[model samples]
Target: MSVTDKDRDILTRTLWGEARGEGLAGQIAVGWTIRNRVDDGKANSWWGESYAGVCQRPYQFSCWNKSDPNYAYLSGAKPIPPREFAQAQIAADQVMAGMVQDPTRGATHYYATSMPKPPVWVKGAKETLRLGHHIFFSDVP
Candidate 1:
């Protein structure tokens, strides 16, 4: 255990909550979006100050919301599936260590493909990449 142990753990859980069904590459893409926010080169970024902050930021990753089904598991009230969690950990480690290419191309925003329509913020945003069931975006401002 170390200073970033919790950060890594939260990031891993986030990957699992948000992209577990998408498999390794999907988790990695989601991880890079978080990493991009963390390294967005701004003091006190709106995205949040750290990995955990960004992941748990209100309304950002729906999984962390108390009402979301994944919240209990991420919060430890419920246990995550060992095998799926292990895959998320690998994706988190790769993104955290900068060991994988950013498939989203520095995207900081995304929406599930299942959404009936794109979120309003996407109106003027640049589409970056689309993989699995998520569509990535950048330059949201």
Candidate 2:
């Protein structure tokens, strides 16, 4: 369960891609969601085994999806604005180092409120937190 340099970098990029516009609080929320997934203790987890894996897993975080506008910056094809990336890195490091409280409250999933419709999996699930433009859920199957 050790965090590596690559994990830190990927997690930083993920926060950048997924929540950069939402500011540091939003990025921290996203980071904790990924940390919850990484620490879920499920063997052969579909969510992936590490921070990098969870972030890079296809279709989980939209920024990694090829069609997302942030993909270019997240994938290094384009440079992230310096200040945004620096904030993302701080969020990633703090979350991974257990230096911050998890505002998501053990949430492993979330969706931006901007979605036209809520994703089906959130149906009947426990809503853990709402921050910025996202809604977070736990107890989702």
Candidate 2, poorest ten consecutive residues by summed lDDT: 16-25
lDDT of 1 by residue, 39-104 (tens): 898987898888988898998999999999999999999999999999999999999988999999
- Candidate 2 lDDT by residue in tens digits, 44-87: 89999999999998889988899899989888999998888899
Best by TM-score: 2
Every model's TM-score: 0.96, 0.97
Global local distance difference test of model 1: 0.93
Candidate 2, superposed: residue stretches over 4 Å from native: none
TM-score of 1: 0.96
